[model samples]
Target: MKKTTILDLVSRKLAPFMLLFGLYLLSYGHMSPGGGFQGGVVIASGVILLFVAQGVGTTASLFPFRTLSLVEAAAFLLLLAAGLAGLAAGAGFLGNPMAGVDVRAVPRVSMILVYNVLIGLKVGAGISFVCMYLFREGR
Candidate 1:
């Protein structure tokens, strides 16, 4: 969709807030309806607002595609590493090391938060990068 300058401005202004809320969604995914993928897509929508308002070049400068790609890759790798750590620690693959973790005498949800955050970031950046590239192709 062709976004007007006003839409763009609104999106830009809302980006940070969307990001914060996305984080919240990811963190609470296990206990709620949202998750890494959902929250990441939400964050991507926020970035898309920038592209719509400022132009791809300008938005890309704000968030370089190369950096976003690297970050996405690294986040995925970190997710894998975290899982591996659980395995190495005597938990099987994809096992929850935090299964035994107690926070204030309550069992912690373990690595769910980390996974959510990483996946959210990866998904958000990856989608935003694609949209930015597509948006640039026309202009």
Candidate 2:
């Protein structure tokens, strides 16, 4: 596939904004409609755009398969650990650990925020890894 200078330049300029939007959605998901899954998809879309515009090799160098795999796995494990922590704390599975604490002491949505961040990371890494693998196979 031949790369065009225009495509490369546009993608380079636009991808950062897409990633920033994704982060915004992830961080404010508890208060808004968008959440981890939406944010992750947005992030993956940005990577995919770069992959198509710059070619898979260049994108892969920036986001290596090994690192993506590790991130996905680590995020998954952490999410599970969070759930287990809730269970061990007698809140049941996926329950909030701060349930008994005073509302004034901590934010009620703190756990949701953690979950959103982890899920966003997991979904973004998993999707990007899959897309990269497919692009590699197509080569």
Q: Whose lDDT is greatest here?
A: 2
Alpha carbon deviation, residue 59, candidate 1 (Å): 1.2
- The per-model lDDT (C-alpha) reads 0.82, 0.91
Candidate 1 residue 70 Cα shift, in angstroms, is 1.0
lDDT (Cα, tens digit) per residue for candidate 1, span 27-80? 889899999999999888878877777777777878998999998899889989
TM-score of each predicted structure versus truth: 0.83, 0.93
Model 2 CA deviation exceeding 4 Å by range: 103-105, 137-139
Off by over 4 Å in 1: 1-5, 100-107
lDDT per residue, candidate 2, 22-94, as tens digits?
A: 9999999999988999999899999999888887888888998899999999999999999998998789999
